[model samples]
Target: MRKKRIIKPLMTRLFREPHFEEMTNEDEMDLKKQDISRSYHQNLETFKSIYSIPKNTDIKLREFTVRSLNRRAFIIYIGTMVDIKNIQEGIVEKLIQSQQPSSKIQDIVSYPIEKTASNIGDIIGFINGGITALFVDGDSTCYLFETTKTRGRSIEKSINEVLVKGAKEAFNEKVIDNIALIRKKIKNENLIVESQTITKRSKNDIFLVYQKDLVNNELLQEVKDRLDSIDSDKVLELSILEQYLEERPKSLFPTILYTERPDRAAAFIEEGHVVLLMPNSPSCLVLPATFWALMHSPEDHYMRVPYGNFIRLLRFLAVFVAAFTSAIYIAITNYHVGMIPPDLLMAIAGTRERVPFPSIVEILMMELAFELIREAGLRVPSPIGPTIGIVGALILGQAAVQANIISPIVIIVIAVSGLSSFIIADVSMNFAIRLTRFLFIFSAGFLGIYGASALFIVGLFYLVSLKSFGTPYFAPMTPYNFSAKDLLIRHVPIKEKLRPGYLKPKDMVRQRKG
Candidate 1:
C-alpha cells in the first residue's frame, strides 16, 4: 500500500453567512469563494420559487408578440395599478408598429426607457407602481413604460390624531404614495428623501426625509452614522429603528415624534426637522423633536388663529393640571387642610370618612382603575372601543365609590386627570404626565405640596436640559428661540413667516411680508 500523505487543512473556521455581495476572484477549487452574478441569479430564483404570491394577486404577467420588431416581449403589471389605455398607445402600439433599426440595446432609440431597473427586483418594482418593464426576448435591456396606479384614496382627514379642524389625510403604508403626499405640500427641490435598506433579508425600505437647507448638518450626519453602525440581521419595525437612532435610549420621554398624518410629516419636514418613512408602516418618525412639538396637532395651525391659540393655551394648562391635580388634592386633604375651601374640605373629608382605605390608597386605586379601563378600551375592537371607554370608566368609577373601597373624591380627581391627559395630541408625552402624577402624589403624602413644588421645579430644569439633536426640548422657553413659538402655538397664517429654530435651521424665514 502507498503511504498515505496527511495534509493538515488550514482555514477551518466556519461562521454565519454575510448578506452583502463579496467580490472575490478565488477559483472554484476553493469552496470559500463565491460568484456574485451566479449567486444573485440563484438567490432570485430561490426567492421566486419560495414566494407564494396568491392567485388573487392582481399583478398580471403577459407575453406578447412584437411583429414590427419581430421579437417576443413580456409585460408584467397589476391592472388596477396602471392606466391600461396608456399602455396600449405608448407601449404595445409602438412596439408593434416600429421597425427594428439596430440589434444593440444601447443603439435602439424610439421612446423613453427607465434605466434604473437592473434585474428581476427592478422588474417587480415597476409592476407594483407606475412604469411597466418590457423585457424583449434575447435582449438584456428592458423598457419601463409609465403606468403608475391612480385609483386610490383621495386626501381625507386622518382617523387617528383626529383634529377637530386639521388636515384629515394620513400617510399610507406605501412608500412612494407617502412621498407624493409630502411633495404636495413642500414643492421645493431642497426636500429630499435618502433611501436606506433596513432589512438585509427582505430589504425593507427606509427613507430619511428632510429639507437639505433647514436641517442640521451635524445631526443629519449623526442620523446616517447611527444607521450605518447597525450590524443587525433585520429591521422589521419603527420601534427598533428609533432605539438605534435616539440619543437617550432608556429615557421615559420620547426623543422622536411618530405620526400617521402626511400633512403633519410634511409640516415637520418644512420646520427643519428630519422625517423618516418606513416601507409598510403608516406611522413614520420625525427626529430631533422638541417636547412642545409632541403636544401640538396640525389643527392647532389650521383652525382660526385665535381659536387655535386658545386651545393651545388650554392644553398647556391641562398638562400642568393633569400632572399635579391628584397630588394637590392629597396634600390639601391629608396635610394642608387649611388651604382647602372650608365647605369643600368638609365635604371631601366626609366622603373620605366612609372609605376603608387611606387617602393615598384610595387615590392609587382610582388611578389604577382608570388606567385599566384605558387599556381595555385600546385592546378592544374599534366598533366597541368607545362603548367600553364610556361604560368601563363611568360604571366602574361609580361602582367603586358606591362600594366604599375607593372614595368619591378620588374618583372625581382621577377623572379630571385622565381627561386632561388626553388633551395633549401626542401619546409619548402622556408618559411624562403619568410619571409626574405619581411623583406629585407621593411627595404630597410625604411632605405636602411643598415637596411636590420642589419636584416640579426639578422636572422643569430636567426638561430644559434635555436636547433633541442639539435643539432644546423646551424651545422659546429654555433655548429661547422666538421664531419657534409663533408657529408652535399656532398663529395668524399671514404673520407666521419664519420656520422653527431647531436642528440647526438653515432658513429662519419661509416667506417675507412685503
Candidate 2:
C-alpha cells in the first residue's frame, strides 16, 4: 500500500499540467491594475513583489524618513537609468534636512515634481521611464520626478544625406534632442509636438510633429488612428513603427520618406506634412511622401535657382539611366541590332567574338557582380571597405575582360548604371529603382524594347493609384493640383510660395501675394 501510494503521487507530480506560469502572469496583471494603498508598508511590499526585489539588483528601493512631515517614505527607481547624485543630494538629502512641519511631500523635495500618480500601473511606467517615484506613509498618490539619465550620442553631421550647403546637423538616438532641433528651426506657436504611447507592454512613445494650424484634421486623425490601432507588445523604433503605419506593407515603393536631417523634417512639417519621431531611431519618418519629395535634396533649395535646376535635371536623367541602361543595351544588341550604325555594330560584334554567353547572360553576370561589391563595401569595416570595393572591382573586371568571360562594353554599362543609382538621395527610392532595374532587364531580354515599355506604362499606372495617407504618390503633377511647380524642376523660393494642395491644408498660401 505504501509503495502504490508513493508511485501514484510521483506519477501525478510528473504528469501534472503546468499552470504556474499562467497563474503568475494573472497575479502580476492584477497587481499592476491595483491602485496605490494609503498604507506605506502595503505599497512597499507590492513594489518589491512586482520588481522581484533582491533578485532585481538594478531596481533600487530606498526607504527614508521625511523629518519635516514626520512621515516614512520610500523612492523606487531603476538604478542604472537614473542619476545617483541627484537622488542623494536633491531628493533624499533635501527631504531629510527640511524643517517645515506642515509642508507637503512636494515641498520637501528639492527636485521639481513632474507629476503625481495613484495607480500602480502608472507608477510602474514612471519607474520604467527612468523617473523616480516617491510613496509617502499617509499619501495615496506617488510623486514622480524627472531623473532620467538616458545615454545617447551627441548631434553629429549627416552621414547618408550629405549636403555641401545646408544644415549639417543630423538627429541622434534621442527624440527630445530631435524635437529641440526642429523647434530651433521653427519658432511658431502653432508648431505642435504631441506624443502617444503606442505599445501595450513597452509603452514606447511616438511623437507627432506638425504645424497645428496648417495640418489637415483628417490626416492627423488618420495618423493617430493607425498608431492607436497597433496591437503589439513593443514597437521600439521609428523603423518598426513605419511598417505598422504604412498603408501597404508589401508594396515595393515606400510611401513614407525617412530622413535623419532635422532641417528636412522641419521643412516638411512647415509644409503641412506630419513627421513621426521615436526614441532610439536616429531618423524621422515623413508622411504623405510624393515622388518629387523623395527625389528632392535639401541642397536643391539652398543653391541658386539655375544651379539647383541643373542638378535636379541631371538627377532626373540619372534615375532613368540607372533603371534602363543595361536593359536597353540587351534589347538593342539582341533584338534591335539593325538600328546600330554599321561601324559601331561591327565594333560591338568584334568585342563579343570571343565571348561565349548571350548579351542577356553577360549583362546579368556583371550586374550581380556590381551589387555584390556594393553590399560588401557597406557591410565591411569602414577603413578597409572602400579599398576593398575599389581594388576588388578593378581586379574582378580586369580578370573577366582578360579571360574573355565578359565583353569590355558590359563593364562600362554596369559601371554607369551603378554610379547613376547613387545620385538618388532617398534609400528606399534607391532600393525601389535598383530592384525595378532588374525587372526591366528580364522584360527586355524576353521582348526587347516593347516589353520594357509595357512594364514602364504599368509602373506608371501603379504610381498613379498609390496613396500615402490619402495624398497621391504623383501629386501636383498627375492629379494637376494647384501648387508649386517643383516636380522635375523646382522654381525659386520667391516663386514657389504655396503649400501642396493635395494635402488640403487649412491654409493654402505659404506667403501672401505681394
Candidate 3:
C-alpha cells in the first residue's frame, strides 16, 4: 500500500492560499534540474550553469574575462555574430561609466532589445541575431548586446526552383527576410504567422503562415496540434522536419511541396493551405501537395494561358517519353518486332545484327552509361561539370556504338530518355520516371506493348491511390475534376477562377466571385 504523507505544518509555513503540494513539487523539480546542470560543469560550475553548453568544447571563450558571479553571473554568445564594438559603445560603456542607479538588478534600463529581453530565452534570440551578450559580476540574468552583423545569401533564383521568368527574388537563409518578402507582396493584416518552437531544438523557429480569415480555424488548429506533437532531438532544416511531420513520408510521391519562391508560397497561402517556414532554411513547404502540383510551375501563370497549357502538356508528354522510351525500344526489338515500322525495323535489325548482347542488355547498358555521365557531371564543379558530361557522353556513346558493344538505335533512345528526364522540375518525380521507364522496358520485353500498357495502368492506379496529407495524389485528373481547365489546359487566368478541389482544403473558393 502506498502511504500518503501529508505535510500539514509544512503546507501552512509556505505562504500559499492553496495547492501547496503541487507548487512544492514543481519547485523541487526546478531546483533539482538546476543542481544537475550545475554539477555537469564540474570546475566550471559558474559558466556552465548559465549557458548549459556541453562539456565537449574545452574552450571557454578565451576572448572574454570570466569572473565568478559569487557575483554569480555570466553571459555567452557566439563571437563572430556578436557586435563587440556595439557592446563596448552601448551596454558595458553605459553601465560601468555611469553613476550607479538602484542596487536592484531589475532597474528598467534603456536599451533597444533589453526592453523585451529580461529572460534567458529572449536574450538568446537577441544574441543569435548578432547582438553581443553582456555579463555583470553577480546578476542571474544575461543581457544581449545587439551587434549581429549583416550576413546571408542575397535573394536570387533558387537552385531547385529555377525559373526562366518569374520573381527574381527567392528566399535567403534569414527567416525574417523571407517572411518580409512575402509580407511585402500580400500586405494584409489577416495574414497570420502562427509560430512554434519544436521540442527537438527549442531554438528552432517554425511559422505556420496563412491568411487568417481565409484559412479555416479548424485547419489552423490541426496544424498547431500536429506541430505540438512533434518531438525530436534536433531539426536542422525544414525538409528533415517535414519528413517526420507529414502523413505519408514513406510514399514515393511527395505530398508536401517546398519552393524557394515566395510568390508561389504566398499563392498557396491565399488558396488557404498551410505553408511552413523554418529557420535557417530558405525553402518553404506547402502541405497537401498533389502530383499535378509538381507538374505545374510558377511560369505557368506568367505566360498566356494557351502557351502555359501547351508547355504543361508538353511537359506531360516529356515525362512519358523519359519513362517509357528505353522500355518500349527493348520490348519492340526483343518481343514485338511486328509493331516496328517495316523500314525502321529493317534499319534496327541491320544495326543490331552486328551486336551480340540481347536488346534488354544493350538498352540497360546504354541507360547505365547515360546515368553515370549525368551523375558525374552533377557531382563535379559546375564550370567543368557540364562540359565533362557533354564531352564524356558524346565520346563514350559514339565509341560504344562504333565498338558494336551497343546499337546506334540504343544510343539515341538512351540520350532522349536522359534528356527527357531532366525536363521535370521535381527530382523525386524524375527518379520515379527513371524507375518506371525500366519497368516499361521489361514489360515490353516480356509481353510487348500489351504488358507495357498493363504495367502502366497498374502503376497509374497506385499513383492515384497514393495521398499526400490526405489529399488525392492524382486529383482533378483521376477523379475527373470537371474544372480540368487548370489541370490540363490553362484557360485565361480569369476563367480558371476556383481553386483545385484536389485537397478539399478548408477554403474552396479562389478568386472573388463577381
Candidate 4:
C-alpha cells in the first residue's frame, strides 16, 4: 500500500568499486603495519633498518647458500647474546651438512630447536633474545633457533637464610635454573608455572608459581591482577615487584616475604601461597605473609618439639630485649628512676655524673654511630666486614666512655639491643624491629614508660588493622582464635593437625591423628 509512496532511495549505490583514494590509503596502511615480507630481500632490509645492522657490530647477519640445492639463505643473531659454540655446532654445522634442502622447516630445525614467528616484531624480539633466525629464499616465514647464553652462579648454599638442617641450595640469577630447583623439590603435576614479560624495554621475565589444586582461587587472582596492574617500563628485581605489589608502601612492616632457599619457597607454595621469581634476583617473594610465619624458621621443624619450643621462647625474649631495652633504659633514667634498685641507681648515677649530655642525647648518639657502622660493614668487602664491626663498636665505645661523652651503661644497652636483633631470623621483621625500637626510644625520651606503653598499644593496633592480600597481618592472636598456640609457641608437629585457618585454604587439613 505504501508502494504509492515508493520514492527513489536517497543513497542507492548498493554495489560499487572502492574509490582510488580509499584503495591507496588502505595499501599505505598495510605497508606501514609491521609484518614479515614475503620477499627475502625485503625482510632482510627491514631487519637491517630496525637493528641498524651495519653500524651495530654486535648483530651478525651471515648470508650463505644451501650447497646441495644451491638455494640462498641468511642467519641473523646477536653475537654476544648467544653461545658461539652452539651456533657453530648446532645451527651452522647442521645447516651446512643437511642434504634435504626442500624439507619442512620443522624437519630442518629438528627437535629442541623449534621454528617460530613470521611477524617482523616477533622476529626482531627473537633475535634480541639470543635466538638465531634463518630466512630461506623461497619460504615466506623465518625460522628461529634457541641459543640463549645465560651466565650465573651454579647452585650454591643459601647465603642470607642459613639453615641448620635443610637443603643448602639457593636460587641464582638464572630463572630457568631456579624453576628447575623448585621442580626438583615439588614433583607434583599441580605445580603450575606461569610467566610473562613485565617490561617492554628490557623484556624482563617474571614467573608466578603455585600449586593448582591447593592454591586459593581468589588469592591467585588477586596476585595476577596486581601484577597486571604494574605499568612500568623496567622492573629489574623481585624487590621492585614487591614494592609494587605491597598494599601499604609507606608501612615499615613488610607484607610480603623474601627467601633465597628453594625449600622454603616450595613450602610456602604448598601452603596455598604464591611465589614470584625474576632474572638477576637470587631470592623469591612469598605473598600473604603472616607475623607468625615470618617468625618461624626451618630449623624449628628440624628440632625436637621441646627444643624447638625453648628456642622459640628465647627468640621471643630476644625480640623484647631488642625493642624495649633501650626505651626502658631511657624511661627508667628520665621518668622512673625509683623503679631501679637503689644500689644500681646509685652506680648508674655515678657513671652519668660526668656525662655532658642528657640520657636521650647520649643514647641517640651511640645508636646513630652503631647504625653507621652496620651500614659500612654491609658495604665493605667480606674480608673487612667483620673487622669493621668489631673495631667500630669496641674501639669507639671504649673511646666514648673514656672521653666521658657517654656513660658505660649506655654502650652496654645499645650493644645488647643490637645483638638481640639478630635472633629474629627474618630480615624484614628484623628491620621492622629496628625501626620500632627507634620509635620506642623517642617515645620513652619524651614521656618515659607511659609514652612507651601508649606507643606499644598503638603499634599493636596498627598491626592488627593491616592486611596482606586479604589475610590479617596479625591473625590468630588479635582475632582470638584457638590457633594462637602456634603464634609465638612451637607445638609438637604431630599435635598440629591443621593449616593456618585465616588463609582459608582450599585444603585445610594438614595431617590426621595416627
Question: Which candidate has the highest TM-score of all?
Answer: 2
| Candidate 1 Cα outliers beyond 4 Å, as residue runs | 1-101, 105-113, 116-156, 482-484, 487-495
Model 4, position 389: C-alpha lDDT score:
95
For model 3, residues 363-431, the per-residue Cα lDDT tens digits are 888877788888898899989999999999989988988899988888888888888888888766777
Per-residue lDDT of model 4, residues 99-218, tens digit only: 875565455544255666776666776787788898877777788888888777998999888877768899999888999999999999999999877776667778999988878899
- Count of clashes in candidate 1: 6
Query: Which digits, one per residue and each the tens of the lDDT, describe model 2 over residues 140-241?
Result: 799999999888899999999999998899999988899999999999999999989999889899999999999999999999998899999999888888
lDDT of each candidate versus the true structure: 0.70, 0.89, 0.69, 0.81
Clashing pairs in 3: 69-72, 69-73, 130-147, 130-148, 131-147, 131-148, 132-145, 323-437, 327-441
Q: Select the stronger candidate by TM-score from 2 and 4.
A: 2
Superposing all C-alpha atoms, what RMSD in Å does each candidate have to the true structure?
Answer: 7.4, 6.2, 7.5, 8.2
What candidate 2 gets wrong by more than 4 Å, as runs, is 1-23
Angstrom error at residue 68, model 1: 8.2
Candidate 2 lDDT for residue 307: 95
What is the TM-score of each predicted model, taking all chains together? 0.77, 0.95, 0.81, 0.90
Error of 4 at 339 (Å): 0.9
In the range 1-514, model 1's lDDT, one tens digit per residue, is: 1111110121111112232123122311232222112232233322222222234366555556676556666566677778787777777676666676656433443445656354545455445545666666655445676667566454465665887765667876567788998998899998898987655444566799998988878888877777777777677777678887777887778878878888888888887778888865667898878887888777778888888888989998999889889998888888888987889888987887878777887888888888888888889999999999999888888888788888877887898998999887777777768877988899888888898898888887877778776678777556666574563466567777777755557878878882
The segments of candidate 4 whose C-alpha lies over 4 angstroms from its true place after superposition are 1-33, 67-70, 480-485
